[model samples]
Target chain A: MRELLRVSAPVDLGAIDPRSTPGLPEATAGEHRKGWAREQVALLGAGLGRRQEMLYATAKAAQERPGPADRPAGRVLLVLQAMDCGGKDGTIKRVAGAMNPLGLHIRSFGPPTPEELRHDFLWRVRRALPPPGYVGIFNRSHYEDVLVARVASLVPEAVWRARYDEINDFERELTDAGVTLVKVLLHISYAEQGARLLERLDDPRKHWKYNPSDIDARARWDDYQAAYAEALSRCATDAAPWFVVPADRKWYRDWAVAHLLKETFDTLALGYPAANFDLGRERERLRAGEAGAGGTGEMNGR
Target chain B: MRELLRVSAPVDLGAIDPRSTPGLPEATAGEHRKGWAREQVALLGAGLGRRQEMLYATAKAAQERPGPADRPAGRVLLVLQAMDCGGKDGTIKRVAGAMNPLGLHIRSFGPPTPEELRHDFLWRVRRALPPPGYVGIFNRSHYEDVLVARVASLVPEAVWRARYDEINDFERELTDAGVTLVKVLLHISYAEQGARLLERLDDPRKHWKYNPSDIDARARWDDYQAAYAEALSRCATDAAPWFVVPADRKWYRDWAVAHLLKETFDTLALGYPAANFDLGRERERLRAGEAGAGGTGEMNGR
Candidate 1:
């Protein structure tokens, strides 16, 4: 049996330098691997753009043939987390925005309800898990209990520490159950965040989305950064590693997210199930006053 | 001022004939008009499919490009009514499924929350309207308090009767604010509804969607039909005419909805705004340690 204790650990936030990270191996690890990482990112970016165009085309085709069982099954789940102005909504609008509705599902989880707060943190999250052949996304997920709550002193340090392990276990369970989780942490600098917040306040229409409390949150920016570093360090398991994306530039953010989502879906091995419709057999069955009496298996054909 | 007392007599449920009557026009309307209606239906079917494809594409493109002002500022609102098996969800998925997330917002209202119940019915609805450059879809919206509640004797007769005028005025407000409302009623046969309900019961995964209370409502199906006819007849205004779609066949349902959505978006004439980039000016600005921002205006140069 797999050892659960060994799998979970508290994330070490303070020690990680964004410059020196797991993505680029140490000098002793060899230049080949480093070159490979860069190549992978480049190749993933190209495949993602191609897949995006194909996805739009496929959705258009599906519109013509409204209900077809032959649609590609299996989907991608993209998880995004960020500080107040982190581009979660913008990310969704671009990457998965054009996905075929039948194949892709985007779910946003705000603050949990009273009933949800009573259960284990993961309960509400598990309920939103996509069914087979669908992609489900969580905007700000169970991670909030550990990251934001801990940083803001909303929860005790011990309570937040205990959750890193819980998150690891939960993610492992999802991966084992055929769900690919791409966790993205949009890392915008304090200066960039200030510009974004000002933009929101400056615009009258966006006033609805701004909260006065966000200012208080901004004051504790360093604490949140420390929390993110810790959570990412601990939870970046082999199964679902976190990507610290530099998000100062909106163009780069789009490119990075598109790369991440494209990579996740490309690995899902989704395709139409293999089956044959024997027209002759269908015609013969129809002739015997059994036109609509095809077995339940026929239902699955669609 | 519009005449408030000019309401047509309510449709008599007992007089409904599936073979004729409301399914087709009265004899007084003439054969040439009938032929025209048939041709429009066919053209609408084909045009709808094409338009649905374009809507998704346009929305996706808009979402990808970030405006300098950060607001494209346009929207489409699609509304429908309530019934256990009402085709709202299906219609939304089929018609507006692949729309760009940036340009699409779908709001589904349940029995109102305490906050919503306190206000007029349109309060919750208007709050849920899409921002500029987006499409807002309402699944079983504000009309419920009027249509179903009126038919089921759930509300006072006077209160429900007043709603017809209220809805027309409310839709006019949306249209004036640059929001286009496309309303559709999926007219299904009693037998078809029975088949769908049975399918839901037989499928374990769909069991949550099955409510025992639906059977009680289905039993009073004729009353619901009469309520729908009465509601549609009154509120089908020139600004936003109600389309009574023959929805026994899902294929035709998709076709009709696609046509309606396509026509609306096509009318908007949306495309990329002009590229106001001055390469020479930008070159000077770059050398002067400043980037001259692209001011917002008629970006029609594209």
Candidate 2:
């Protein structure tokens, strides 16, 4: 499934079919695949809870280790990128939403604040990075500098093109600091995206989710696609690879994400910290109470 | 119940009975007080969940308010202090633990690092404060500068004495900025703490919780009680009044904390962010999704 879905090398995204559902259940004749895909997502969700708990515990105990350091405890960051209404928010709700908030953080990148713009593009991103022993989900992440900025001519061609190497180096630095990078590009066809954008306009409850900029970008779809293809090809490395997901079916998008997360956790090889206190002396003292206490404070009495 | 627990003005440390369960149910002769208190805690927990959710939503919408600014959205910070085995950790697990992690963060303070020691005592504390819309729980807080620094002779009498006004002014700044501060000192009896420390030795799983410094602090029970009495007296104000929680029994402690939180939320006058988007345009857009929606990329000059 991973081999079929992952883009280890550069490929023309235009050749990929967005509506085609592969690496998931085969569509039976006259069958509702949403129900089946939803069931799979549920099953994956159940397993995710237990695995996430262990991962959190492992992360907490990593600093005070009396345990194996084979796979050092740290953070896993999942970066999500796609066209507007590409189900980044939906993916967050269905998959990342199941996570423990204590260790799971979602950072949605919007336009840069004045303070953020005062520094390099990565400055705000650096601040939002998850602390050790947690997972961070980035919705419409740092890639926008290349994707939107290049397509709209917000920056010159040379500058946006040069960001590919910078992003790769930045990711490698994170990997060096015990971080796992899961970069995903939710691939949707041109026609499917137009439908999703129009659907947003029609649903009043979802008006908050709609942005006017979406249509302007949609007007330059080919440029954005080319930018994404270039970014995915250049930035996807041995340490951090890109997953090009077929996202016309929201359920399949969620299921594949959960599957990828499960695979990531499995590789972490997490375990609970070992207990490191004397059992016998502790028992004897418990029964004795303060009769066996008062050694230190007495020495430095007020 | 709140009047009984809160310290609106200066109060005596020695006069207050730690064993007295005045604000909670009395464990009368053959009375199932534990079961009753547990039931009450559960009820409060359920209400806490709902109120907290509203607070979170209200906070998120505060910045985009077409709503009243009279009760603007903000953050809540709970500062917990007590001698060893006074149940700061237990209080966090049972109380703040119930709130959504999306907006609830707990910071456990230990000895200052070299960099921290170089800054003002409030520097690190200010940094760990909950971001707007969050509930930040401090297991041990900056009040330690006055309490431990005074009782242990770590600083001159004048240095610790001067910190009282500093803390008051700092808290006043936070209150002005819309943060609600709930400061609590979990007051446990000397004998009860000795018993808890001893019991920790008996349980293997609890060994990780037992620190050697706990016993040292326990020996200075009288001194710490005096330090706490003074700190509470000097710092308690309208914006951030101090609550002395009787922590002999863990259930009662958790219940009182939750009760106080419910009171805080009730006073917040929190309302959901009002719907302010264009409903008519949204409905029209939704209807259009099934109609004219498939022209881009090829239609564009791309």
Candidate 3:
């Protein structure tokens, strides 16, 4: 699934169908297909949860043992990008939501604050990176510097264009520092987005999510698509690949992203860290209610 | 359940049985009780999820519409504190884990960093407070200043004693600013903790969570209990009350917290914010794919 969705070469955004379920089993009934996708997502989510726990445990052990300070442990950053009314929020609620919140760090990037704008665009991104041994999710991440900045003329053409290479280089540094990147673009059709927008307008409950400026972006949908194509093509790398998941069908998008996360974690080959202390003696001491054991005050303070 | 567990009057911690299931239904089989409690937690969780969405939506609407700056929207903070192996982590996984991660902010407070120590104890806590419309969780929180600080004699007696009043003032301030506090202490017996520690030592996968200093805290259980009783009694108020949830049973603990949250949100009387724009015009414009409609760029740039 990763290989199929991955942008290994220059890709034409227009060639891909936003409604395609490339790897999903064919079913005559749409409801059956949706149910199958939902089940797949749940199955994949259970695996993802286990992997995330192992990753967190490994980092905690490293912290307790105090190894070389410079050496970094493995971590993950799942970056989600999409157009207005796309399924970024829904995808997060379904996929990342399945993992334990203790080991999950979620940051939703909005327009830059005055403090953020004063520094380089990547500065805030750097600050939000996951610490060692956790999964950090960015719902609409630094990709906006290239995508939105380019489409809306938020920055100069040269500036936004230069960010593609800058992003690639920055991601490479993160990979070297033990941060695995799962970058995905929730690909939804223009017509689907219009329908979603109309639905939101039609539901009083969804009014909080609706904004007038969404139509402006929809009007310039072609420009945004061109921007996304260039960004995905230029920034796709061996270390930090970009996956374009068909997102018009929310269930398929959820399942695909969960699958991507599970597969990516499997590649890490994570396992529970071996106990550093004497197990037999610790067990005896714990059973006897012994005080002042061999460990530090760090965990005790909890 | 709220009234049953709330610390309204001076209370006796020792009189409460750690294994007691206060509001849980009676069942002949232990597994049956566990199953019933688990189902109840899930049912309450579903309602909690909807209320949380409403809270988040209300806040988002206020932000977009630019309401009075001083009047804060409703938000919730769930503070969990317990002895070693008392099930704080398990409770969070089963309860807050059921809510959407997008509107959840979870901060686990370990021992103070040097920077944290340099400021008032509540300084780091204030920094970690949930923003409006979000549910913020503190796995271990500012109450540590009283519990650990008093038990370990980390500060002068006068200083730690004065903090009770200070904490009440701070909590009052938070409540005045629209932050509802659901403070809970997961009550567990000393023997149960010993058993849990030994179990951790027995399992390789659980070793990462075990620390030698845990026994030290366990040995000082009486002092910690006194500290907790005083803190709970002194801080209990109409604005921000404390609940002593019997937590030896993990299922009951999860259900009680979820129930507490659901009831608290019910008191808030949260509902979907009324649409600030003309519903008819917005629906027609969205249908026509109109550009530059009535709202701002905040929701755009997604």
Number of clashes recorded per candidate: 8, 3, 0
Ranking by DockQ: 3, 2, 1
Name the top lDDT candidate.
3
- lDDT-superior candidate, 1 or 2: 2
- TM for candidate 2 is 0.75
Q: Which stretches of candidate 2 lie over 4 Å from their true place?
A: A1-5, A10-73, A82-101, A104-108, A185-230, A244-259, A275-289, A292-302, B1-5, B11-73, B82-100, B186-210, B244-259, B275-277, B281-292, B295-302
TM-score for chain A in each prediction: 0.71, 0.88, 0.93
Enumerate residue pairs that collide in model 3. none
Residues A248-269 of candidate 1 have per-residue lDDT tens digits of 5554566556666765656654
Clashing pairs in 2: A202-B285, A202-B286, A286-B198
Per-residue accuracy of model 3 over B1-302 as CA lDDT, tens digit each: 78989985576788788878887756535658788878887788788888999999999988887856656898999999999899999988889888888889899999999999999999999999999999999999999999999988889999999998999999999999999999999998776787799889878879888988897888888788888988988899889999999887888889889998988998898999888878787666675653443343322222
* Residue A190 shift from truth in candidate 1, angstroms: 20
Worst 10 residues of 2 chain A by lDDT: A293-302
Question: How displaced is residue A299 in candidate 2, in Å?
Answer: 22
Residues A1-302, candidate 3: write the lDDT tens digits: 88888985576877788888887756635668887878888788888888999999998888877868555788999999999988999998999878888889999899999999999999999999989988999999999999878888889999988898899999999999999999999998876787798888878778888888887788777788888988888988999999999888898899889988988998998999998888887776775664443343322222
lDDT of each: 0.59, 0.74, 0.86
* Best-matching candidate per TM-score: 3
Query: If both were scored by DockQ, which would come out higher, candidate 2 or candidate 3?
Result: 3
Position A291, candidate 1: lDDT: 27
